[model samples]
Target: MQTESVKLPRLITPLIDALTNVVVIENGAIVKNTLSETALTITNDMPQSLIDSLFQSDNPVVQHNQKAAEAAYTFKITANRTLEAPINLFIIQKDRNMSQNLTFIVGEHAGVTVNEYIYGNDGSTVDYVSQAVVEAAGKLDYHGIVNLDAASISSINRMVSVKQDGKAFIKTAQMGNGNTQQDTRIDLLGPLAIGEIKTVALSSAKQEVLIRSIIEHKAKHTEGLIEQYGVAADESFLMFEGVGKIHKGMSKSIAKQHNKGVVLGEKARLDANPLLLIDEYDVEAGHGAAIGQIDEEQLYYLMSRGLSEKDAQRLIINGYLHPLEKLLENDIVKKHIESLLENKTA
Candidate 1:
C-alpha cells in the first residue's frame, strides 16, 4: 500500500473499457464512486498485459482483501473503502497464452457482482479461481459464463464463506463447440448462511463437460440448492458429480441436487452421479438426476402442425434452456445466453 497510488478509487487501472472513469478512495475510506447517467461505463477495462503489470507492481491501488496463484493472472480488486454500491469486475482472455488469478473481499453490509468470461482464439486451457471472503452480514453474487470454442479447458474454483445472516449466490452458463471441460466447487460455511448455485452447459459434436459441486453445511439453519442442467448434440458427452452433506449439529440444513440432461445422438453419452452424505436427523437433503432423449411424439405433434423436425428440435432445446434464461436479469447478458443456446440448436 503506497501513499500515492492508494489515492485512486480502484486498485486496477481502467484499460479495456475506455468508457470507464476514475474512482476516488483513500485509506479505508471511499472518497467517491459515481458516474453520470450519460456515462457508458462506470467500471474500467484494461488489457491483460497491463493488469498483469499492476499485480506485479504490488503498489496497492485501493484496499483489496485479495490473493492468487503465482504468475498466471492480470487483475486484483478490493472494495474501494467499505464499498457502497455493488462493484462489478470483468475478466477476459483473448490470447491462447492468457491466464488469470483473482481474489475479492466483500465487507460487512457491502456486496459485489463478479462477472468472468474465458475464451481463446487458438484454443487455450486456463486454470483459475475467483475466491471471495464474505464478512458477517455481507453478500456476494457471482455470474460466470465460459464460451470455450473447440480445444479450450477452464475451471472455476470458487469458495464463499457466509456469516450468521449472510448469503452467497453463484450462477454459470457454459457452451462450447469442439472439445471443452469445466470444473466447479462451492461450500456454505456459517450458521444461518445460504448458498445457492445454478449451472447450464451445452455441448455439440465430440465436446465434453464434467460438472461437479459440493455443499457442506457447517452450522444450523444453513440452506443450499444446487441445480445443474446440460444439453448435448451430435455425439457430445456430459459427466456430472454432485455431493451434498450435513455434518453433526447442523440442524435444519436443506440441500437438494437435481440434474436433467438431453442427449440427441446415437453416439452421445451422459453420465450422472448424485450423492448425499447425511450425518444426523432433523435435516432435509436429497438428489435427483435424469438423462434422456427428446420425445419423438412431441416432435411429431409439432410436425403435424406444419413445423419441420429441425424446427421442432429447436423448440425442445430452447425449452431446456428457458429455466436458466429466466434467472438472468441483465439484458446484454441474457441476450448473449440466448445466442449461445441458439447456436446449439442446429
Candidate 2:
C-alpha cells in the first residue's frame, strides 16, 4: 500500500467537503482509506459464501475480475439510519491492468449514497465489479464516473438486488476516450421494490463505447425503469442498450426502457436498443429508442446569436445531456458533471 499522495480528478474537487470517508484503490490494491464517524462501516473481511453468491455470473471477464482482485471492500450501512454524506471511492490504474470488487449492503430502513470514480492512464486496462443489496425498506443511491485515456480500456459490471419496499437508483457518466463497456443489472426480488438506471455516455476520437442495462421485476407491484443517453463524435461509435423484464406471477408490476443518442461527426455512429420481455399478463411493460443527429435549426439559431460554431454545437450537446444532471441532489456534483459534459463537447 503506497499511501504517499495521488493525483485526484477535478470532478471530485467539489465533493471534498463531504468526503469524510474516502477509499482509494491503485494498481488493483487498496492504497489508502480514511473513515469517519458515521453509521456506515467499511471492511475488507466478508463471508466467503456472500462473496461467492454475489459473484455468480459466468462471464469470463467477471470471473477474472473476481479472481484477480487484490483488494475488496464491503460497505454496510446500519439499519434505520440515513447517511447525510456520500462515500467517495477512487480507483486509478497506471500503465497496467487492474481489477477490483466492491460490495454495498444497506440494512432495513437505512439510506446511503456512494460516488465512484475510475480513472486510467494511457495503455492501462481496468475491470471493476460491484454488487449492491438493499434490504427491505432500504434506499441506495449509486453514482459512477469512468474516464480513461485514449489508449486505455475499461470494463464495469454492476449488480443490484432490492427487497420488499426497497429502492435503488444507479446513475453513471462514462467518458469514452478509450474502449469502454458497462453492464448493469438490477433485480426486484420483493413486493413493491423499485429500481432505476440512468446513464450518460460521451464518445470522441476513434473510441468505442457500449452501455447495457437490465432491470427485472420478480415480485408483485414491483417497478423498474432504464434510461440511457449517448453522444458520439469524431468517427467514434457509441451504443446504449436497455432491457426491462417482468417475471411470471408478478402481477401489477411495471417496467419501462428508453434510450436516445446523438451523432456529431459525419463518420460517427450511434445506436440505441430498448427491449422489454414480460412473462406476466398483468404487468405493464414498454420500450422506446431514438437516434439522430443534432437539430440543425437549433445549431443555426445559436450560431446566429454571435456564438462561434463550436460554441453553438457545444451548447446544443450540453442541453441534450443536461437532464442527466437533475438526477443528482447535490449541486456541486451536478456542476462537476456539467463541466465534464462541456469538456467532452469541446
Candidate 3:
C-alpha cells in the first residue's frame, strides 16, 4: 500500500486554484507498482526503448493528455504470474481541475485486474488518460466508475494495444449528472488477439454525455466486440459513436458493435451510431444501433400487476442496467449504481 500527492504545475493552472490530491496505489503479490512525478516508473527488466515506446500513441486525445499530464502512476506484471487479488486505484477531486496519466504493462502469460474509481464535486473539471499494453498470451481486465456531481465536466481518454494471443476486457459505468465525454481505442496488433468493451451511461437534468470508441484489427484471427447502453431524462442528451475496423490483409478477423439507448422524458434526446469498416477478404464485421423510449406494453403489464407507474419505471430501469453489474463485480460499484438509480427515479 502506498499513497502520494501530486500538484499541478503553474503553467497549466488556469483561473482555478492549483489542484493537489492524494492517490492510493496497492500492489498485489504478483504485480509490481511504480510511482513518479513526471513519467511512468518501470521496474521490469524490459529494455528502456520498449518502455519509452509505450508512451507514444497516435491518438490525438492521448497525445494531448500525455502533454498535459503532471503526474503518472504505472503498474507492471511479470511473465507467467497471475495476481491473486485485484489492484484498486482511487482518485478524489477537490477545488481545481485534475490532469493525470496511468499506464499498465502486462508481461507474457501474465494476468491482472484493475478497478478504478473517480469522483468529484460540483463545477469541477477532470481530465484522465490511461494507456495499456499487453504482451503475447497476457490478459487484462479493467473496470472503471465515474460519478461526478451536477454541473461538473469530465473527459476520459484511453488507448490499449494487445499483442499476439493477448486478451483485454474493459467495462465502464458513467453515472454522472453533468457533462462528460469518453474516448477509447483498442488495437489488436497481433494474431489471435481479442478485445471486449462495454459501457453504460446515465444523464439527467440538462446534462450532456458523449461516448466514442474504436476497435481496430490489424492481424489475422483477431476479434473485437463493443457494446454501449445509455439512458436519458429531463431534457438531457446522450450520444454513442462506435466503429470497428479491419485492416487490409487481416483475414479471419471478426468485429462487432452494438449501441442502444432509452429515453425516459419527452424532451430528452438520444443518438446511437455503430459503424463497421473492412478492407480485407474473408473477414466478418457488423454493427447495429437503436435509440428509443421504454416499451409502453411492458409498463402497462407491470402496472396491471398492482405496481405504481413510478415503481414500474424503476423496475424497468433496474432490469436495463442489471447487465452492467455483472461486469463490475464489486460491492462498492454496485452500491454506487444503486444510489444513482434511486436518485434518477426519485
Considering every candidate listed, which one attains the maximal TM-score? 2
Kindly give the stretch of ten consecutive residues in candidate 1 with the minimal lDDT sum: 57-66
**Candidate 3 structure quality by residue, lDDT tens digits, 115-165:** 666666676778878888999999988777777778678888777899999
Best by lDDT: 2
Off by over 4 Å in 3: 1-61
> Which lDDT value does model 3 have at 223?
98
Ranking by TM-score: 2, 3, 1
Give the runs in model 2 whose Cα sits over 4 Å from its true position.
Answer: 1-20, 29-34, 300-309, 326-335
Q: Is candidate 1 or candidate 3 better by TM-score?
A: 3
lDDT of 2 by residue, 1-346 (tens): 3433343344443454455567777775676677574788878843357658644676789877676676677889999998877777777777677777888999999998888878776777778888889999999988887877788888899989899999999988897478989998998999999999988899988889989999988789999999888889888989888889888899999998888788987999998888888898998888888788887898889988999988887777776665356445566666666777777766
lDDT of 2 at 172: 84
- Runs off by more than 4 Å, candidate 1: 1-88, 178-180, 296-307
Estimate the TM-score for candidate 2.
0.90
Model 1 C-alpha lDDT per residue in residues 279-323, reported as the tens digit of each score: 879999888987888877888999999998888888877767654
Report lDDT (Cα) of residue 120, candidate 1: 38
